[model samples]
Target: MKEYKFLRILDKFEKIYTKIGVDYDKMRLILSMKLTLDSRRTSTIMQDQNKNNNEEDKNIFNRALIIYAIMGIFIGITAMVSFNNMYKFSILFGMFMFLVLTIFISDFSNVLLDIRDKNIIGTKGIDNKTINAAKITHICYYIFLTSLALSWLAIIGSFRQSPLVGIIFILELIVIDVFMIVLTALLYLLVLRVFDGEKVKDIINFAQIALVIIMTISYQFLGRMFDIVDLNIIYKSKIWNLFFPPMWFAAPIYAIEGGHINQIIIALIVLAIIVPIIAIILYIKNTSKFENSLSKLNIAKDNEKEKKRGLFYKIGRNLCFNNEEKAVYDLSTSIIKKEREFKLMTYPSLGFVVIFPLLFILIFSVDSFSEIKNISLHMSLNIYWFIFMVPTILMALQYSKDYKAAWIYQSTFVNDKRNIYKGAYKAVISNLLLPLYLLESIMFIVIFGMKVIPILIIGFIFMLIFIVIQHIISKNKLPFTLKMGEIDKGQNIISTLLGMVILGVAVGVNYFILINTYLLIIYGVILTIITFIMWKKCILDFSTN
Candidate 1:
């Protein structure tokens, strides 16, 4: 009986061991796999960290050392070359270079910070506990502070000889630095929130236009402040006193006055009041409507998509060898397949027209209205031409990309090449050109008033002509391509140069016509005829193959 019980216990123990048996080899393999994955992840993180460190070091060196060195050399060279005017040339050159460098560094650093934040936030499977927004913010704030320090250092190095002037300069630098930082932050946020997707490009362009306007208007103000002009008008009306106030504008004046605390206090008070008021107004306006503005933008995006779909359908049918229904179906499929390409074609075109005006406002301000008017009138005619022409180049790039992705398969189904050309032409005109032209018309009317109607009509006609020319130049190729991120520098240069030549002619015509109604009509008629002829020739050539 004892032997049997012992055997039974042994049997049960064997069964339990079998159920929980470990395959040593398999366990080892699993361990190895986990180790490999962990190692790879660690390696990737280390590599990314190294890359980021390197980039940060490079930017620091470039901004802090390289830029200063370049400015110093440039100033020295200019001073030497100018001989007798060495002091004057050096001062002016130093001022200009420092200003430009400050702007560039500020812009570049902001972009880099954005890219870094995006990368960090986008990292996969990172523990929420490990992420620190405050850390990132601190780092960015320090980087900006460092850049400002470098900028100031450069300024001091440039003008160290004059102690009194240096003191005034340092004070001015402090004021400007604080102002620019606040302004840049506000503007950056405003742009990102206000402009969606590719519309940011339009804002940038508008900022450029604004700069041109501001420069023209500010020239008189600057001249008066510097005492370069003895215009009694500047001293008489106290307009200069109110508008071009001494606090910031009279840096030279302050240097000459030699540390008058009372005057500085008065200026500071005026600035304090003005700055807070502006900031409050901007904050209130932006905060109040930001949400609604974003919603409207989203709606606009949906509308744009619908318009694109409608255009593709219409054009696709025109390009088809078969029945309209079949063509429409084919086109829709093609578009769906190449949605990214379509976006690429559309976004840039929209950006060109929409962003320029906003950018103009930012850079030039309202004070430069006269210069703005002159430049706008001169460039207005070519704006449409550029609007139409640029898409062709962008389309060519897109088409090349699409072709690589096998989008060319759609072409094989078409009975004639002309059908394909016709569809693409129609697609571009309806989807891109018409919307942009409408926007341009609205902008011109707003900026130039009722007098711009004739110019708008003339511009539209020229725009049509340019589109045909672009199609012909591109040899009836679909603007959709599959190549990603490949830029043809040669083609870009050629296209840009050609567009400029056309612009020159438009400007010349505007100059001759001035505000004469009959002259405007005559010019418009002539331009329309020329454009129509060009369109016919180009379209015929494009349709042939």
Candidate 2:
């Protein structure tokens, strides 16, 4: 039995050697082949291990997927119910869903593309080639064209039953197409080339901001014009089409029938006369100073860098002379600036706020003073809550981004460990949290007016407290450097639970204190005191770190 087992083992070894391209007679060759084969097998095993690890992580976060699925079902059911009622609510809900889905998908795709771009950097292999600038530009152009074409097609399709309507639609489409083509071309030139400096590789960043502002103003004017113009005449008149474009001609007719023809004509004449003058002035001004301005900006940046270096050196020299408190404060300020990027790219979802408010006002048409007052109160409350929540979420995201970038390198400079922690805490508050709160306050005041000033003050105080609590929880409990996609889901869960608890307590406190003008003042004062104490403690804690 022992002899048989030995023979079987030898046979297995021989088969293994032969399968791995090894010659049994040549011992050295056989050994080398075995080593190579073993290495490859080990690599394959490691890859499989990693795959299993990723799968495990996905399983751990399976709840996120379930939550999203549930949300989808709820929204779908609500939409169906609204549709059955024959209310425009269903249509609005459908549009909202479409917008949200599109935005999320597009944003996520962009994130993936960015990661791919980063991975491909400096890779020379053909298989790992990066997307070129021309390819990106082409893709953007195609997306724009396809969207425009689809919009035109949808409009035309809706008017298929009426030849006159179809004709008007076609004429309108042509005018819009011509205007957009010219506007886009001009925008591309002005923003992509004119503003792009040596340091700016992504001209799209600046172009997007300019495009938003231009589109907002343009649409406002177009809507007014459409109220005045006669679509039929505008469609039929070749001369008017050539001179004014279909959109411009149609607007006046629409406005005329809508009893705003005089206003529309006056606005159009003013725009026609002023637009060229403004364009000429801007062109001349930019052309004359563009090179000089760019040179100066570069020089200023260099000087700024030098100043930072000098300040660092000075701090280093005076390390022993200055009190720890002052040193911590200065370090924290620097860290905040570094982390926040000085609000260069930190803006709330302006598109959501703009579009939603306009739609709400238009659809509801609250003409009565009482109705308007109620809307103002309800909207004010909702807006404040949204403002508080959205910014907190965004600030969390900003923290994640900075953390992922390994910005803790700046902390390495500080000798005191307490100061390091302090710096980080201060950085988040000063840079990310403060600006958002300030913006929220501005938006609230604009929307709600001075009547709710007391409420606004109280709300602001509560928001600050919430922010501090969130920061403490995030810092101590949650891991830094979360993936961008995961942050929103994670934040939603935490914020919902915590926000409800806090709001519940706040409501109880307000009721206990009395819910009138005096209550507002009292709440505001209490909030102010709490905010001050919390802030001071935060600063002290940060400094110690």
Tell me the tens digit of each residue's lDDT in model 2 across 477-521.
Answer: 222333332333355557557766776677566545533777678
- Give the whole-model CA lDDT for all candidates, comma-separated: 0.44, 0.39
The sequence of per-residue lDDT tens digits that candidate 1 reaches over residues 260-312 is: 43554355446634774576346334432332232322222323444445754
RMSD per candidate (Å) reads 16.6, 16.7
The top-ranked prediction according to TM-score is 1
Top model by lDDT, which number?
Answer: 1
Give the backbone clash total of model 1. 30
Cα deviation at 206, candidate 1, in Å, is 10
